[model samples]
Target: MLQFRLIVPADLTDEVAELITSTVGATHLTLLKGAALDPVGDLMTCDVAREAADPLLAGLRGLGLEERGLIAVDSVDMSLSRRSDDAERDAPGDGADAVLWDSMAELTEDESTLTVTYLAFLSVATMLAAYGVMLDSSILIVGAMAVGPEFGPLAGICTGLVIRRKQLVARSAKALVVGFLAAMLVTGAFAALLDLFGLFSRSQFERPHPATQFIWQPTADSFVVALLAGIAGVLSLTSAKSGALVGVAISVTTVPAAANAALALSYTAWHEVLGSAWQLALNLAGIVVAGLVTLLVQKWVWHRQRGRAAATSPPAP
Candidate 1:
């Protein structure tokens, strides 16, 4: 569950309260008449389940409460919530299910933007992937994927698409495209240097490297892997179970494909280079489709709960 602190104009108090109360996902709502600074306003504090947040928030916008006051939603650490015998028997683990619900509801592009650690990791990972693909080293490719930070923004892009957040979509796409391009260029330059010294060549790159061969052929299987990985990736984001993301790290060929393309360009093997480029596009598309669908389902479930709330609650007096 999440806690909301709502401040609204006095004139809209009745409608705002009615809106909050009418929200099926909200519970433990407490209303206040006035605070010193908000004498011309009203205040409301409430706890709401995740599945209920979307529609309730939408209703607030519909009621114009969105513009009337400060509406801030904060997380509740259920691990810190005091347990009681009053804990409902059906509640998901001391209301952690509610916590999970709210967190997912809170998922936004602004929320998913890369942080310092995120930037650092992604930079190193992309570099690693670029070099690995250039060398046609599968082991290095795998290692690069482990380091590449592309997944976060990729996930963000899909999140933006589902939520229709243009800012998020732009942010995510810029990060993905720019980040990969920069990494590839650097890695490609390095590969060119390696080839100039006869360390590797276009012929060498086209030669078999079992570990890096995945990029040579883009199959239906590759799309399936990316699609499944994308679904898992979003699940991790919504459930706040990021630990599961490590496995997702290895499941897609984005970094390797990127490295392959960069190295291919460096070696001037147009065919192998073009193939890897297609591989990158395929994987990115698969993830986006899967991610959009997953978020859509979550949105639908949240919307249905609000519909039920509207059915049960009467309008204000």
Candidate 2:
């Protein structure tokens, strides 16, 4: 369950309470007046189930009591009454099962804006990618893939499109494109500078490293890997199974392929560069398409379940 702290004038509190009380899924309701000294409204606390959060939030939006005897929904947090139950269920080694549609809905919590944390992670991943190529290290490439930040926005985009939220879709797509372009360009320049100094010989790009061969070759297996990984990635994000996310990242080859393209270009291996670039595009498109479709399917299933649950269960008291 989620808790809400709303502050409103004593006079307006009754009407506001009535509005929220009438809102479906509001399991508990209470009102307090002048309990808050803030210039804003007074404080009231209430709880609602997770499935009811969205509609409740929608109902609360209009209560912004900035003027007159105002009402404000100041904050919300999960209630601990059931914390032990959920925490035990989500313990490590147990796959975190989450509702995929609800998971997607959660991404809009902050309205899909890019955060500084994502930029820092992307920077580190880009550097690791360049270093991996320089040292001919598969492990580093995998690490970079696992650490890459683009997936959040990619997931956001898929989620937004499924929910028909254009603002979220636009923001997420911008983040994804800008992050990719910035990382690739920076890594490319670094790789070129390293090549010029003979820090890593250009010969490494040509000598067949079995690890990178996949970047230059496209096959049905590539699509299958991307499709399955995309599905797993979404599921892991929504559920408690985030540990599996690192493996999903490495499996997709997005960051690795981008790094390979930049490294190959630095060495002026035009053919290899083209192949790597194509591979990057193919992998990203595969992930996006598969993610969008998965979310859509999940949303449909969730609605059916919700309908069934509503039909079978009585309304909340």
Identify the candidate with maximal TM-score: 2
Q: What digit string (tens of lDDT, one per residue) describes model 2 on residues 240-291?
A: 4679878788888777777777777777888878887788777888888888
What's the lDDT for all of these models?
A: 0.70, 0.67
Candidate 1 per-residue lDDT, tens place, 77-113, comes to 6723322122222122223222233234345454446
TM-score of 1: 0.75
Count of backbone clashes for each model?
Answer: 6, 5
Model 1 score (lDDT): 0.70
TM per candidate: 0.75, 0.78
- Candidate 2's displacement at residue 125, Å, is 1.7
C-alpha lDDT of residue 245 in model 2: 75
